[model samples]
Target: MTNHNLYLRLVGDRFEKTASQPFLIIPGRRPLLFSELDRMTGCVAARLLELNVEPGDRVMVQVAKSPESVLVYLACLRIGAIYTPLNPAYTTAEVSYFMTDSKPQLLICQPIERESLFDLSLACKVPHIRTLGSDGDGDLMHGLESLTPEMTVVEREADDLAAILYTSGTTGRSKGAMLTHHNLASNAEVLHSYWHWQDQHDVLLHALPVFHVHGLFVALHCALLGCSTVYFLSRFDTGQVIDRLPDCTVMMGVPTFYTRLLSDARLTPELCSKMRLFISGSAPLLAETHREFEQRSGFQILERYGMTEAGMITSNPYHGDRLAGTVGYALPGVSVRIADNNGNELPRGEIGVLELKGPNVFKGYWQMPEKSAAEFRQGGWFISGDNAIMDQTGRISIVGRAKDLIISGGYNIYPKEIEAVIDTIPGVAESAVVGVPHADFGEAVAAIVVKDGSRQLGEQEIIEPLQGRLARFKQPKRVFFVDELPRNSMGKVQKAELRDTYKESFGSK
Candidate 1:
């Protein structure tokens, strides 16, 4: 009777000790306690059973980050269904691709997305479709009506698939990562132990979207393990975050959140004093933004590293020395290494591809054995497509994405290293570096920068600072000013898209 899915086991453990703590809090809505979420999930599980939603059945949810969305995810886990969270911002085509590829038995979506999604569902001719939202006038809460169907929780196994998270796929087609109950449960426990999350004392502010790993799985799942209060946000807004600061103890966000917070006039030392920890991930944190926010708020943002394939790899310590530019050491139960092009282990100080092997590594890309095999090695190590260098002090600094490497005039250049230096400049707000075809150099370094002030910076002024830091060929030959860089849902720079946008300019040469 006590056994259920992976999520229920963990929740049962915490509820026995700390059930009265605030489990979830939305800005304008009432907060839910652990006991409330527990009851809600049970009701949802019972309803799912009545609908004959079997174990391993695919269930899709496309809604904003709210208590209902959170509850829906837990219900799927408690009853042994594979949860699929979709981006609310996805286009009809993008949504259709996932729906057709996964072929889920049921699709749950918000009101605004319902019409387009329903058409997609019918066009794809899926089996079932459900919509949520009071205004949408669909089967929103009707599915949660009274039901006490038998609990099939005991049949669920640790290796049973829990969720199928689709990669953002900014560069190419999206592939689903099959995360098992064991994979997710183990990672949650690892983060709970490594981050030292305890019950009844911490109030976490959750502002990131649920589609990404950082927001949905890492932060929310980790907070549930501790029975901490989750201050939810439908979407991230700097003004809203600053307003809630007086009561929140913990905050997790991406680099874009920090940049906006630093520019907000509402943030002050007194307002932020209530927070004990501030975490950033899903994208690299610029060193300049790190220093500026620290100087302004007196809290050094702890930057961590993770991906859709692996839940969370490394994090700057909560108590120890938190470095500004580095992503700190690998977390417990995880092994990280830097390797050369041949997959040989490189020296500690050298920059190379980063490889990880641990309990948190995903099973593999869903059904793509060839691509999956290429991503892994003879051992259990999963080769992340990221480039990194390890310092003597045991910190890992990401250089750039390996696929984003640019070759200019026979010299190899990493965009992240260049962007880092450009980010340090006073007038520059953001920058993206790419390679363009050149008749003379084979490819030339191209820079796209976003400026904050009216200061006009020429190509020479931008490339001068890198004279000694980079080789002559590695320096950018042309610099273009832009209002903003193209970013995906997770705020990651879409360099491939930029390369395509400027392909015509390269043809001029």
Candidate 2:
């Protein structure tokens, strides 16, 4: 039987040849080589085994991004333990909910948070707890030199669970998405080829957080598969990214990153001359941002579409025309179609729910069998809950989330349509359109906008222009201006929060 462990597929055969090569280049710290990373993971795996962490046991980790934190992830994979990572920004109440749900045998948190989390862990019935700090000092790495390394990779079937990542839970309690060895491995391999990863030559500017799929699986996995050097950043900083752009070949980031870069005076085409690709995901990339980035940097941003349930469904081609508003063709071996609520496929150029079926799709939502079953159709297609349209050329353009659809006077209004127009207006930076409760219309369209600070503007200025451009029902009845919009960790606007904030906008109408 074959050992289908994800660790082996990622680092087994190429270890010796790439041992001395630089793996991670961190600012103000020594570069960590592939051999050092391997040794560290081995030691961490040995430590996990010492704690009696057997195969399939859940290992929950919530530590700040660092080389040592990554070692914990690789260590879990090495021993065939199901790795569960949480955002470091999650509150104690949120952590408690995850702990009670996952019921992990072992929990690793930051040293500063250990005292509080220790009590929480005991209350949640988690057996063991350890700490790993951002600077590589904590209980998890104590006395590593004396311990023997665990060099043997545990055997796992392709269908065995490898990780469980939770959703953002904007609408309700977050559901854990169970990912198997094959689910992650197949996606990584396909992306390695699809993105044209160049072995030993590509230097990746990795600024995205490691807790999410964009940074952890898509970015890191591709770099590991190609033995590429990564410029590991603690967080996304505009100055750091601009300084490192000349030395890097590829950068994967959210749309916010590009917008921030464009705002800076230091950004120039010469600074990004060495960059080969700039890929954006985790949130929608506005057509205006895409066009501005290309105009300033002399490179088009490759926008892709994906979700927590699936690693990656579609991507703009690496060697072809990357249309500004479209997330180009579905990946090889992945099937995508626009479908109605009943799951019947829609014809080309029509908007409907996007459904996908592929190896990269997750097994199911953890411990929520009914919810998982409800998300899939009879033919094993996963309902993506996203409204999208397919072009004649097979490219997919996401309109908005189904939950973001606004119904006013019995007319369906897509938020993206309003946002796109608002973003194009002079002195308007960005906008988020949402539906608020209204006694008359059931729901009334509302707009929350951010101005570019170039000129003074009023609600009338924003509303007057939309009168001719949009239908009366589709236009926002109320326009509210703010310095910025609320966003999640991945840079996605929190529309649910907006809806809640402005629920009484109509004054009990």
Best by TM-score: 2
Tell me each candidate's TM-score: 0.78, 0.81
How well does candidate 1 score on lDDT at residue 450? 91
Global lDDT of each model? Answer: 0.77, 0.87
For model 2, what is the alpha-carbon lDDT of residue 416?
76
lDDT (Cα, tens digit) per residue for candidate 1, span 229-316: 7888777777788888888888988776887788787777788888888898766676777888888898999998887888889989
Q: At residue 469, what lDDT does model 1 achieve? A: 49
Name the lDDT value of residue 104 in candidate 1: 84
In model 1, the runs with Cα more than 4 Å from the true position are 1-4, 134-138, 149-154, 169-171, 405-509
TM-score of 1: 0.78
Q: Once model 1 is optimally superposed onto the true structure by TM-score, how far is the C-alpha of residue 471 displaced, in angstroms?
A: 38
Off by over 4 Å in 2: 404-509
Clashing pairs in 1: none
